[model samples]
Target: MASSLHFLLLFSSLLYNFSIYQAKPFNPTDGLIFHVKKDVSTLQYVTEIHIGTPLLLSKLAVDLGGPFPWFNCAPSSSSRLVNKRSIQCLAAKPKTHQYQGSNKKCHIFTENRITQMAIQGDLVEDIMAINQVTDGSKTGSKSITTVDYNFQFSCAPMLLLNGLASGAKGMLGLGRTQMSLTSQISAQLSSKLQFIICLSSSNGVVLHENGHRSSNFRTKIPDSMIYTPLVNQVETPHEYVINLKSIKISGKKLSLGIEEGKIKLSTIVPYTTMESSIYATFTKAYEQTATSMNITRVSPVAPFGQCFSSRENDGTLVGPKVPAIDLVLQSEMVKWRIHGRNSMVQELLG
Candidate 1:
């Protein structure tokens, strides 16, 4: 998550109105939300979405770079909502576009970029049960109410579910597309085209209708949120890419050539990875800083090249006491700092 995963989600076009059974109807402008959590074994963040009647809950893996969301399912209850204009053939591969269907009904072509497979799925529409929270704005007490929403999603076969969380029934598309999670909810439930995703949050995910900040949910750091312009490259409009000016260790800038770096955020990867040239310079600086701090270096591990004997050193609350690794973006004032917990991984050997 640290610096590897992107800080963005997707959007969709399919719209729907909200309804409640017994209580007064909720405002259409209120934010809609679903519960999301991180799977320890697979390291994939998943969210529970209530789909179909009788409220059948389905676990979907959250993908930041993924365009449209699709899941492995039989989808007997949901009806077909095939796109009349176009259909997605391959979700993520070398080439991407609508796979045209001549005579037969079009099956939406989508895939999980993380699993690296394409799925020709039938677009299905169903009544979705979404959680709506009262922020005590119009009402004094904070309470949660379940509202029904109708939306469209793609369904694939069970064979395509590979390299994904065993418990995950499907993938949640939170990327920049016409069929992304945010876009659909924003278009239908609320007029505002914005949604908040607390990836490391312990509190419940609630969409604010009046756009008021709540003490219950917040960022990891208090009063710390950096906003920068997102660069829209026509080449990869769906991919979340941010402009990184430079990398600094202990406030010292490293030589990463003249070209400005563009980092792509990922939902699949758990840790940050760099090219050999960048790794050489980055790790060398960190190792030197660790050496000065009297931290012991151990044998190499599988994925990580630099292993440290963390037992010898009492690290900070975050992790080991090492020099700060920062990603300077846009300007010197805007910096994404990577502390110990995120910078070093603690390993246990048998």
Candidate 2:
């Protein structure tokens, strides 16, 4: 189970670092870049964006799962409204209706039905400035740059705020829907449907449009970067899905049972909640491997099983060295290696 858990974590990390690009003209000089602020605890990445004519600085969560970009606005807040005319154009009464290009309809909060806030607002064009960072020299002097773009976005007047954190001002949607950020900016770049996100080890994350670097933004991937074909979800076409065939640990194949079941390998969402049956099967196999290695197991770590104790008293995890993991995709001869720090994570408790 521990090994499988480690493999799952590695898979999530790889997906997090994965970049999608479309083949097109090589400009190397035109692109929009934005610096992302990541919250380690929730793994949420946010970036500052300026909206409206006077420029209101708003922090928006970068979400790959959301289909539309929207910002919270009080009914009377001028900062959220682009102009007086835009605010006056809103519907006189909130109506329960479906969003454009989606089948889901808005529903009022009730005891039996799920509580949902009806999204009511005007679609208006606004100038948006994305924050970026540039390295001055090899010594790492940094400079801030703002890339401005004009696009239409939704301003939700009655957006729900009960479950959101105070820092979450809005959401910058990156899903495959037609109203997403990718679609809104497709006309300005050569690669009409692609973008890249490179998380930094330092203070901020970087976003590249069309997978190309401009004078202010640049990134390079290793020559050995692997590529995989993405699958489509017929019902929810806006979601990103991929295929996986099997999982192996230390060169030994485990019974993933993908072929015998109806599991489509459609979703590869991060921070997934595994089914108990699947979790138990992987756990049993992991425990068997650990026992065969003659390694002593300690008390189970909270939220994680099969943790071994360290020799020192600092509450650091030490152990039987974890083995390499490999993810066998549906593509022939395509196996992603999970090694080094990705194969094992050491957590310290205070």
Top candidate, metric TM-score: 1
Per residue, candidate 2 scores C-alpha lDDT tens digits across 143-241 of 445655666556654344333334666667666766667666665444557765554222344355554332333434554767767657577465555
Q: Which stretches of candidate 1 lie over 4 Å from their true place?
A: 1-24, 86-104, 137-140, 201-224
Candidate 1 residue-wise lDDT, 200-270, digit = tens:
52122424343435412331225666876666768768767877888989888988664577677666676
Best by lDDT: 1
Could you give the C-alpha RMSD of every candidate to the true structure, in order shown?
Answer: 6.1, 8.5
Q: Looking at model 2, which ten-residue stretch has the lowest summed lDDT?
A: 106-115
lDDT of 2: 0.49
Residue pairs clashing in model 1 are 10-174, 10-175, 11-183, 12-183, 12-184, 88-109
Name the runs in model 2 displaced over 4 angstroms: 1-28, 74-124, 132-144, 157-159, 200-206, 211-219, 260-270, 293-295, 310-320, 343-346
What TM-score does each of the candidates earn? 0.82, 0.67
